[model samples]
Target: MVAITEMTNWAVDLIDVRKTYGKAIQALRGVNIQVGRGEIFGLLGPNGAGKSTLVKIMMTVVRPTQALGTILGRPLGHRGKLAATGYLPENHSFPGYLTGAKLLDYYAALSKVPRSVRGPRAGELLERLGLSRWGSTRIDKYSKGMLQRLGIAQALMNEPELVVLDEPTDGLDPVGRRDVRNLLLDLKQRGNTVFLNSHLLSELEMVCDRVSILVNGLVARQGTLSELTERTVEYEITCVSDVASLAGKLLRLGATVAGPVVTLPGHDIAKVNEAVDCLRSANVAIHAITPKRVGLEDILVEAMGGQDAKPSATPPTSPPAARPAGPHGDS
Candidate 1:
């Protein structure tokens, strides 16, 4: 298992970050999180769960009541370090008049990218994000998928050491989502770190190496994918024949069977071995044996105690508008 080690090289290390609104609304409660270098980290929670508020603090867009930690090895809210970072916030709005290509250049400039590199950087980002053909088209005419791609390109313009994304796949269809997944994987391969927050649990499952689930202004759960899914990880066993007698024996052992298939619903390797021995003893034809992992949504649902709406201790308040580290086009 590849993991970002707990060390001084942590890309993000925010400890006891607390935020409150007015007199009683607590948005964050001692939120402590650590992200490793060159890893795709996913943060998850329902609406008004301080997910947005936490990310805003990272970009220094919203001041936390109290936060003591380091980001990219610098103190929290260190502006000089932000120049090397890329950010794509949720509900990001771009200038409607600018073409897709121009949009990238504008955001890049905000990151303080040199003039010599902006043009080439913008072109390369457009092409990589599959927006090369539509570079000349205005954003007002672009589709939802196109706009999402443009937002990603804008974040990458500076070739940042670390990138922060919030709900990056908000409006994308399946095919477009696949493309985004591929792009994220490519970024990881290039040794850049990604810190992601999204409501789409499946998308996070596909790309995140580690995840933290924040519920009611606190981190309810946090770990690697395998660690998070440890409780419900399952294995499957398949046999070629639908032998009735063997089915009964396996059934008594609590295995689910469906015509030549037996599903052992636990992570125990021994049970799998026991099932295999039973099949062999019964002279049943053995077909295949494999493991099936649980989904992140299931874990999240369990973590939140099966709640459907925002599980907040306080009433909802308007969150800050999503904005990049620099002038992210228009508000």
Candidate 2:
């Protein structure tokens, strides 16, 4: 059952969403997510974490057991709002007989974009996505990277306010991935909301303004990259001279010594300074000192390991307050 609430400024707001596949298999436990307008929000998780199930529910492709929220300021599955949104599924299949331009035209038409606008829009999107030369080429003749690019172009044909993409760079090479990253930033600049579902941690880290990590059908962590990685995990000091002889003394100071490196666990600046002083007094040649923080991969691994154990660093703070709508109007 879904309860329609008053319209909101959020591009996507889901609350207590749940789904059950059979009599016993629970695909999604209670899950809640909020995406601000005009931001690139990334969804991440290991396989079987219900990431796809949540996205399908948002797109109305799968019925939820219980849900409440708004998408684009209207109730879920609202036709007008649906028309204003675009989606690219995980393994989308398009007709092989259609040319690249034709496919874009078809998708745009389905989105109710005016016939007069489709042609110019198709051409512009093809060029923007590096498919101008392949506009007239049959999709069957396109390479995997080209097909992926075409799929992205199709998703933007309507100039949608909200674009939901699942694995947008699934088949692209490094350069292609970089291009997609740039394109996502461009969309944010145009005040468009993007909900990205992908397994590529480094890519998400670079592009996403905020992210949510789902583990075992629940959101284990959700926040901006800086908020999530605010705590310094450790400090590493690299020295030109071997420090293996000082292992016992360094260990006594809550640091570990290996070869020419001295590692101080946790965010203790005083301890790090003490180690540095010790090395300096010993006439050790220090090369560099670096502080390390937990990244997205580290967060994901910790989430998957469950919250029972003590985390290596402080947990992320709560998500920030709702942001105002962008220039594109209420999301």
C-alpha TM-scores of all predictions: 0.83, 0.89
Q: Return the top candidate by lDDT.
A: 2
lDDT of 2 by residue, 89-157 (tens): 888888999999999999999989999999999999999999999999999999999999999999899
True-vs-predicted CA distance for residue 136, candidate 2, Å: 1.1
- Clashing residue pairs in all predictions, respectively, total 0, 0
Model 1: per-residue lDDT, tens digit, 245-317?
A: 6777888767888877687766666777777778877777565555554457766776788854222221112
Model 2 Cα displacement at 127 (Å)? 0.6
Looking at model 2, report the run of 10 residues with the lowest lDDT sum: 322-331
- True-structure Cα RMSD, model 2: 8.5
